[model samples]
Target: MKLERKHALVLLAIAAWNVLTYLRFIKALVDTEDRPTGYYVAHTILIVVNLLIAALLGTWGVRAYKASKASQNAQV
Candidate 1:
């Protein structure tokens, strides 16, 4: 499967956005100390999940970009 440059860029952007949004969520969670233990635990789990998703997207984007580049080079 040949990945296009635009698709790779979109994936990278989504990954970056996910990270940024997670940071904001963390900040909000930290700012409130009155939350229950369950609240913290749930948010922590969500944060971990989001981080994993972001990592996956970033990895996919890098791999796609590399694959596209390799294909281009091979075609030359």
Candidate 2:
């Protein structure tokens, strides 16, 4: 498959994981009966922020991979 196709597949997977994981996190936050102390809210927010960072890194990886492949093909 082409680099673009691979990137698209990876992006799709990441999007799916992002949506599903965020839904779970939101559910945990809203379902808590103890009225969500500060720590619990902070932790949930941290988890979300971390996942978003990971997603950004994954996007960078895809871009790097494509650029490298293009350079190699140009040299060939």
Candidate 3:
């Protein structure tokens, strides 16, 4: 589906939220070094995956926003 400017904005907002929330989670995880190696390993994997997702969403949002702007400019 083609994304409008509003949809692109929402995706960017979500991506931003994910990064901010996960950064805090990482800090908390770091403080809790008492956890077992397995626990840390699992959480680390989750963090990595979430960050990757955020990156992907952010990229999509930027591309969509740019495309929409370009189309509008061309039409004007």
Q: Could you say which candidate leads in lDDT? A: 3
By lDDT, rank the candidates, best first: 3, 1, 2
Q: Report the lDDT tens digits of candidate 3 across residue range 13-71.
A: 98999999999999999989577899999999999999999999999999999988988
* True-vs-predicted CA distance for residue 31, candidate 3, Å: 0.5
The parts of candidate 2 lying over 4 Å away from their true place are: 1-36
- Over 4 Å off in model 3, which ranges? none
Write one digit per residue (lDDT tens) for candidate 2, span 1-76. 4455456557657766876787787778777776648868797877778678667856765775677678779879
TM-score of each: 0.90, 0.53, 0.95
Kindly give the number of clashing pairs for every candidate.
Answer: 0, 0, 0
Error of 2 at 69 (Å): 0.7
Superior by TM-score: candidate 2 or candidate 3: 3
Candidate 1: tens digits of C-alpha lDDT, residues 18-68 = 999999999999998887899999999999999999999999999888887
Q: Give the Cα error of residue 23 in candidate 3, in Å.
A: 0.4
Alpha-carbon local distance difference test for all models: 0.92, 0.70, 0.93
Candidate 1 vs. true structure, TM-score: 0.90
TM-score for candidate 3, residues paired by index: 0.95
